[model samples]
Target chain A: MSRIILYTRFNRFWHWTQALLILLLAVTGFEVRGTFRIFGYLRAVNLHHGLSLALMTLVLFAAFWHLTTGEWRQYLPTRVFLKEMAAFYLTGIFRGAPHPVRKERTAKLNPLQRLAYLGFKVLIIPVQFTTGALYFFYPNLNAHAWPAGFLWGVSTLHVLGAFGLLAFLVGHVYLTTTGHTPLANLKAMLVGYEEDA
Target chain B: MTNMTSPSGPIRPPRPGRFIQALAGLMVLFLPVLATQPPPGPAHGAYGRVRAERNRDVTADHTRFKVLQGPFKDGDGSAVTRACLTCHVKAADQVMATRHWNWRPAATDRKGYGKSTHLVNNFCISTLGGNQEACSRCHAGYGMTDRTFDFTKAENVDCLVCHDTTGDYEKVKGGYPNPAVPLAEIAQKVGRTSNQTCGVCHFFGGGADATKHGDLDDTLLKAPRSLDVHLSRDGAAMSCTDCHGARSHEVAGPDYGAPADRREQPRFAGEAVSRMACTACHTATPHASFVLNRHYRKVACQTCHIPAYARGGLASNLSWTWSTAGRLKGGRPYEDKDANGLVTYNTIHGDMVWAKNVKPEYVFYDGSMDFTLLTDPLPATRPVVLNPLHGSYADPDARIWPFKRHDGDQPFDPVQNRLVAPWTAGPKGSGAYWGDYDWDTAIRLGMEKAGLPYSGKFGFVKTSMWWPITHMVAPKEQALACGECHSRQGRLARVKGFYLPGRDRAPGLDFLGWGLVLLTFCATLVHGASRVLASRSRRNP
Candidate 1:
C-alpha cells in the first residue's frame, strides 16, 4: 500500500462546500415546487435563491482555479480500462477481484467518472441555471408575442433536471464505498490523501 | 333664465365686529406677557381645543367667506346653486359633463352602453318606463322627473348633495333637496367629499343600505382597521376623495374604458394620469417574497387582499326574484323578515336573499363589459349575464378579478325575445305594478312609455349582474396564503388553462422518477451486502 496527496486544500474545501450547497438547494427547491413543506413556502423560496447564488459563485471560482492550475485535465475521458472498470463493479468486486484502474498522481478520475462529471457540468447544471434564470425574470418577459404558457414549460424542465441531479447524487455517493476499503474514499476526501494498493 | 333668481333671497351685508377687533388689539399688546407664560395645562382645556382645531387641511373656512353667509329662502335648490354660480362661473358646466350628471360615459361607439339609455341591470330592472319619477331621486340634478328635464340649465345642479359636511342633508323625490334640510346651513358648511357624502347614494343603491355593491356600505362611515386599511380611523384614516381625486369634476374610479391590468409603476412626482388604481400607489412587485410578487401579472391585488366582503354587520342583497311579487295577506300587501331581520319577501320587491361576509366569485375581466340592451336578443339559456365582462385566460390585458354576482329572475318578453321594463311605481290606478298589482297592465303601459313592442305575455328569466369588488381591503396579515391557491382543492383550482405545481401533477412522470430512485437504492444495497460478505469470507480463510 502507498499513500499520496490526491487532493489539495482548496480542492477539498470546494468539494465539501459544493456537496453541502447541492443538498440544501435540492431540499429548498423541492419544497418550492410543492413536493414538501418543511421550510414553508416563502422561506423555501428565499433559501433556494440564496443557495443557488452560493453554488454559482463557487462553481465560477472552481472553474477559474481549474483553468489556471491545469487540474481540469484530470477529468479527461480515456478508453483505457473503461470496460474493465465497468466489469469490476458489475461482478468482479463481489468475488474479491482486483480493480482494473489505479489512482495516479496525474489522473484521479476513471473513464466513467470523467464521462458522468462531464454530463453533469454540460447538461444538468446548464439546464438548471437557464430555467431558473428564466423563472426569475418572468415578470419582465411581457412581450406581446410571447406565449402565455412559457413559464410553465420552463418550470417543468427545471423540475425534471432536479430529478436527474438527485439520481446522480445517489449513485455518486454509493460509488464512494467501492474504494480499497469501504470508508477509504471518504477518509481520503476528508484528509486530502489517498491510500491505494 | 327666468329660474336664475336667487332663492336664498339676497346676500345680506355684514356688520363690523368692533368688540372682536378691540379684543384682538388688546391681546396683541399683551403678547409678550402671554409668550412668557408656560404651556397650557390640561385644566386649561379651551386653549388646547382651539389649537387642535387650527391644525386642519382646509385652506379657507366657508363660514368666514362673505358670499356664503345668508338668510336663505327655500323654494328650490336652484336658488342655492345660483348663489354658488356667482363666484364659481365654470363649476356648474364642469359638473354637467360628468357621469354623475348623465348616468352614462362620454360618447363611445359601443351601442347600448349607458345607464340612462338602453343599459339595464337585474336589480330594479330599468328606469325607461314610467319608473323614472321614483328613480330620479338619485340623479345629481333637480326636477329630472322625466328625460325632458333640460340639461343646459346650470341652476338645476345641486352642489350641496356631494359637498355637504352636515350628514343631515337629504334628497327627496324629483332629485330636489328635502325642504326640511336647512339648505342654507348645509351650503355654508360645504367641504371636500367624505365617506358619508359618497355613501349617501352609493351605499343605498338597489333600495336600502348594503343592497347593491357589497364592498360599499354604512359600515365604512367610521370603519375599524380590521375592515379597511385605508378608510379605517385606526389605520390610514383616509377620506374617499384622497384616492378618487376630482380633476375638472371627473372623479377617478375604475374607468370602464381602460384595461383592468395596469402595468405601470407607482405614480411619479408630477404624472399626468391620476388613476384610482392600486398600482397608482403600489408597485406591481409590492410583496417581500419574489414568488408572491410574480403573481401580480396574472392575478389582481384585490383577489388576495380582499379575502371576503360585505363584512361588518350589514348583509348584502344576494338575489331577487320578481316573479314572487304581488303576494298579499289578509287582502293587504305584507312583508316577511328573516332570522337576521333582513327582508326576505316584500310585496313590492318580491323574494330576496341577503348574505354577509360573502366570498367573491373569481373571473377574468379586461375592464370593458358587453351590455344586453332592449334591442338585443335574449339567450335561450337562463341565468344570462346582463353585463358580461369581456376577458379570457389568453388575453394579456386581463387579470383574474373578484366579483359579487347578484342573481335575479326579472320580467321578459318571450315574443320579442327581449327584456321588458315594467312601471313598478306611480300614482294609484295609473297601471303601475305597485299601484294596481297587475303585471299585464304594468307591462302594457310600461312598454308604451319605453317605445318597445311587448307580447302582452311576460315571464321571469333568470339573470346575473357582476359587480367588481375593489374596496374593503383587509390588513396585510389577512391576505390569502400561497397554499390557498397552491393546494389540490384550493382557490385557483377552478381557474383553468394553466398547470399549477402542487394542485396538478403528471402520474407518469412521478411514477418513473420514484421508480428510478427505488432501483438505485436496491442496487446499492445489493452491491454493499455482497462486498461485505466477500470481505468476511476472505478474513476467515
Candidate 2:
C-alpha cells in the first residue's frame, strides 16, 4: 500500500468549514421553524442568518481557489466507468470483487462521486444559497407586482430546499462509510492523504 | 309693490333683496327671449342659492311662497316643519318611523336580536336605564325625555339635523345632544348631508370621541389616505352616506349585529341597499393569485387587510369597571385619566381601560353575535360573555375573523341573577348614583324602570364583549405574511375545531411522508453494507 496526497490543505479547510456551516444552518433553520427548539425563534433566525453569510463567504473563496488551482475540473462528471462503479457497490462488492476505479492524487473521486458532487456544487448548493438569501433579506424584496401569496411561495420553496440539502447530506455521510475502512476516507479528508484501495 | 298680508300673518320680505334686484335686472335683459326661449332646468348657485329655475317642474321659490313668507317664517323647528310638510306631506311619516327618531331598530335576521335600545353592553349595560337623555346625546332627535316620549308626533321629527347643508348646525351638550341650530336658516339651505352631518353624532358617541366604535373617530375627518382610503379627502373623498345609502329616510346597514354571510345585492334606484358588507364593493375573489383566491373561501378579507385597529392614534375603550365608581378624593367625585387622556376612573362610572394599535384576537365568525341580555341568568363560576361573536369552524358561512375584545366589571343582582343598570345620571330625588351615591336606591329605581327584578344586594362580575374589527386597514405591504398563520403556532393557534396546514400534524400522514425519505436513506446504507458483507462471505467460501 502507498500513501498519496488526496486532498489539498485549502480543500480540507473548505470541506470541514462548509460541512460545519451546513450542519449549523440546518439545526438553526429547523429551530426557527419550530421543528426543534434548542435556541429560541428570534436567536435561531439571527444565527441562521449569520451562518448563511459565513457559508456563502466560504463558497466564494473555495470557488476562487478551485478556479485558480485548476482543481475545478476535478468535479466534472464523466460517463466512463460511472455504470461500473455503481454496479461494484450494488453487486460486484458482494462477490469479493476489487474496486472498479482506482484513486489517485490528481483524480481522487470515482465517476459516481464526481457526478453527485457536481450536482451539489452547481444545482443544490446554489439553490440553497439563493433561497436562503431571499429569506435573510426578505423585508427588502420588492414584491409590488408579486401576488399576495408570493412571499408564502418563496418561504415554501426555501423549506423545500432545506429538505433537499438534508437528503444530500445523508447520502454524502453514507458514501463516506463506503470506503475500504470507514475511517479511511474520513482521515484522508482531515489530514489530506489516502491509501489506494 | 304693495305690502301683502298672508293667511297666517303679514308677509315678510326676502332677507337678501340684492338677489331679487339682480333677478329683476336679468329678467329685463332677457325679456326679448322670454317669449321664444325654452324653460331652464334647476341649477344651484353659490351657497346653495337657486341661481335659476326655469323648469316648471321645480317648486316655486319658497321665499315667494305665502306660507313660508308669513310672520312666523323664522320660528322654531316645529313651526318650520309644519309649513314645509304642507308641501312635503310624506317626509314626516318617513322620518318619524326610522331608528334615528325612534332610537330603536327592528331585527334583520333571527340571530340579530338586539338593538341600541335593548343591547346589554359592557359600555353602559342597557339604554333601558332610567337615564335615556344622557344616552340620547348620540340620538338623532332633539328631546327624548323618557320611554314615554311620543314617536307619532310629526313635530318631534327634526329634519334639519340631517338635511342642514350649512355647517352651522352642531349638537352641543346640555340636557341632551340637541344641535340648537337656527331652524329657518337650516330649512332654507337644506340639501344633501355631508360627512360632517353623520360624524357629529356617530363619531362622538358613547360619551367621548372614538370611545364606542374602534373604526370611526374624529380622525376620519382629516385623515391621511393611509388611515382610511375611502374617507381620505385626498383619495376617494367618500361621505358616510355614500356607503350607508339611504332612501325614504331609512339608512341601509346593520347596526345591532355583524352578518355571518351576505351575498351582494344590487341597489336599485330609490331603494335602500341594506346589505352593508365589504363584499358589496369588492368581490369574493379580489386577488389575482389562485392560492389567494382559495384563501378567500376560509379567511375573511378584514382578517388579512386590517392588521391593526385604532391605527389613527385614537385609542378605543378596551375595558370598563363600574364596581369602583363611588371612590372619591378630597370629598368630591374623583376623576383620573391615563396617559392617553382616557378616563381611567370617574367617581360616577368607575374604571376604564383604553388601548390603541391593538392586535385583534382571531376567531371563526359568521357575522351574528349572541349577547347575554340583562334578564339572562348569570353563571355562578364562569366569566360572562356580554357579547360573544357567534361562529363555528365547521360552519360554511364562517370565516376566520379579527375582533377587538372589550372586557368589563359591572354589577348584577345576586339573588335575582339579572344585570342591573343603576340610575347613574339624574337629580337627587331620582335615586341616581351620580346624584346621591346610593347603590340600593339607584338599583331599585333602575330595575323598576326596566320592569325587571333586582336584589337589593349587588355583586360585581367580570364580563367581556367582542367588537368586530373591520377598519384602519393597513397598506398591502403591512399585511401579515403567510408564515404568520401557516406555522405550528401561528396566529390561528387559538382557533379550534379546524385543520390548518403547517400548524396541524397528522401523525399517520406525516409518518408516511418522512417514511419514504427515511426508507431511501436506510436502503442505500443497508444495500452498501450487505454488498460488502456478501463479498467477504464469497471470499471465505
Candidate 3:
C-alpha cells in the first residue's frame, strides 16, 4: 500500500467549507419551508439568506479555481469502465472482487464518480442557485403583473430542489465508504492524502 | 491570472491577505446602507418632531381677543359659532360640505350611502322618522330637530365642540352647550381639539361611552403609554387633530377614506395626505426584523400592533338583539345589568353583549365597502353583512386588517325582503320604539320618512357590522409575537385565501418527501448491515 496527495490544501478547504455551508443552509431552508423548526421563522429566514450569500461567494471562488487550475476537467464524464464500476458496486463488492478503477495522480476520479459529480455540479447546483435567487427577489417582482401562480410554481421548484439535494447528500455520504477502506475517502478529503492500492 | 508553474503541479492559491482585504472593502461599502436604516422601535421621536414643527402656537390668545371675550349666555353655542364665522368667513362652507355636518354623503355619493339616509347600522338602527331629534344630540349642528333645519346657516355650525380647550364645554341635546356650562369662560379658552373634545361625540357613539368604535373611549383621555402610545403623555402626547390634520374645518380621518393598503413612506409636515393612517407618521416597513418587514406587503400594521380592540377598561358593544326590546317590568321599561355591572339588557335598546380587550376578527380589506342600502333587497344569508368590506387575498392591493365585528338581530321586512329602520326615540305620542314600545309604528314612520317602501309585515333578521380598528396601539414589546399566528390553532386560523408556513402544509408533498427520506435511510441501513456481515464472514472463514 502507498499513500499519495489526493486533494490540495485549497481543494480540501473548499470541500469542507462547502459541506458545512450546505448543511447549515439545509437546516435553515427546511425551517423556512415549514419542515421541523429549529431556529424561529424570522431567524431561519435571516440565517438562510446569510448562508446563501456565503455559499454564492464560495461557489464563485471555487469556479475561478476550477477554471484557472484546470480542475474542472476532472469531472468530465466518460463511458470507459462505467459498466465495470456499476458491476463492482452491485455484486462484486460482497464477493471480494477487484475494483474496476484505481486511485492515480493524473486520473483521480473513476467513470462513475465523474458522471455523479458532473451531474451534481452541472444540473443540481445551477437549478438550486437559479431557483433560490428568484425566490429571494420575488417581492421585488410583485409590482410587475407576472402570470398568476408564478410564485407558487417557483416555490414548489425550490422545495423540490431542496429535497433532491438532501437525497444527494445521503447517497454521497454512503458511497464515500465504498472506497478501499470505509473511512479512507473521508480521511482523504480531510487531510488531503489517500492510502491507495 | 495563469500559473507560471508546470501544469502537473498543484495550483497555488491567491494570497490570503488579498482575499481579506477584498472582504474588508466590501464591508466598508455596505456601511452606508447599514447606517441609513431608521432606528427601530415605534418611531416616536420622528413623528413627534414632525408634529411639533407644524403645530406651532402662532394664534393670538383667545382670552385677550375681545371677539372671544364674551359674556355669552349658557346654552347659546350659536353665538360663539357666529363670532367665529365673523373672522373665518368660509369655515361654515367647509364644515357643511363634510359628512360630519350632513350625517349623510352627498346625494350623488353612491346614491347617498350614509347613516342618516340609506345606510343602517346594528346599533341605534337609524335616525330617520321622529328619532332624528334625539339622535341629533351628537350632530355638529344646533337645533337640527328635523330635515327643516337649515344647512346653509353659518351660526348652526358648532365650532366650539371640536376646538374647545376647556373640558367643561359640553354638547347637550340639539348640539347646544349645557345650560349650566360657563359658555363665556369656555369660549375664551378655546384653542384646539383635545381627546376630551373629540371623545364627547366619538367615544359616546352608538348612544353610550365606548359603544361604537372599540378602539376609542373616555379611557384615552388620560391613557398611559400601554393604552395608546400616540395620545398618552408618557409617549408622543398627541391630540386628535395631530394625525387627523384639521385643515379648513375638514377633519381628515376614516370618514374621508380608508385605504387598506398604502406603500408610501412617512410624510413630513406640509405633505399632509389627509389620511388618519399609521403610515401618516410611521414608515410602511417599520420593523427591525426583515421577516417582519416582509409582512408589511400583506399584513396591516394594525393587525400586529393593535393585537386586540376595546383594550381600555370600558367595554365596547359587541352584540345587540333589538328583537328582545319592549321587555318591561311591571308595565314599566327597565334595564338589566350583568354580573360585571354592565347594562346587558335595556327595554329601549335590547339584549346586548359588551366585551373588553376583545380580540379583533381578521378580514382582507381593499378599502372599498358595500353597504346594504335602504332600498336594496335583503340578502339570503343570515346574519347579513351590513357593510361588507370589499377585498380578498386575490386582490394584490388588499391587506389583512383587524376589525371589531358587532353582531345584531334587528327588524327586517321579510315580505319586502328589505331591512326596516325603526325610529328608536321620541315623545310617547310619536311613532317611536322607545316611547310607544311599538315596532310596527316606528318602522312605518322611519320607512315613510326615508321615502323607502316597507311591507306591513316585519320580522327580525340577524346582521353584522364591521368597524376597522386602527387605534389603541400598544408599545413595541406588546406587539404580537411570531408564534401567535404561525401555529395550527393560531390567531389567523380562520383567515383564509393565503398560505401560512407553519399553519399550512401540503400533506401530499409531506408524505411523498418523508416517504422517500425514510426509504433512503432504510436502504442505507440494510446496505451497510449486509456489507458488515459479508466482511465478518470473510474474516471468520
- Say which candidate scores most in TM-score: 3
Q: Which candidate is the best by DockQ?
A: 3
DockQ of 3: 0.35
Q: In model 2, which runs have C-alpha deviations exceeding 4 angstroms?
A: A1-97, A100-165, A172-197, B1-76, B107-117, B172-180, B267-272, B487-490, B502-541
lDDT by residue (A120-158, candidate 2, tens digit) is 888878878776666554434443234545545555656
| lDDT (tens digit, per residue) of candidate 2 on B270-342 | 4557545667766667654434555656688778777777888888888888888888788788889977687
Displacement of residue B30 (Cα, Å) in model 2 is: 73
| Superposed Cα deviation of residue A3, candidate 3 (Å) | 2.4
A1-197, model 3: which lDDT tens digit per residue? 44567787678767766787788788988887766678776667777777777778888989999899888988989998999999888777887777779877657899988998898898878888888887777666673256545556666667777777787788789988988788878867765667554
Docking class of 1: incorrect
TM-score of the first chain in candidate 2 relative to the native first chain: 0.95
| lDDT (10s digit) by residue, model 3, range B74-177 | 79988988888878888888999877798876555555766567678778877765566778878888887765778778799988887777687777666777
Report iRMS (Å) of candidate 3.
5.1
| Model 2 lDDT at residue A55 | 77
How good is the docking of model 2, by CAPRI class?
incorrect
For model 3, the stretches where C-alpha displacement exceeds 4 angstroms are A143-148, B1-59, B64-72, B86-90, B106-111, B261-275, B283-294, B328-347, B427-431, B482-490, B500-503
Clash count for each candidate, listed in order shown: 1, 5, 0
Error of 3 at B195 (Å): 2.3
TM-score of chain B of each: 0.82, 0.77, 0.85
DockQ of candidate 1 against the true complex: 0.17
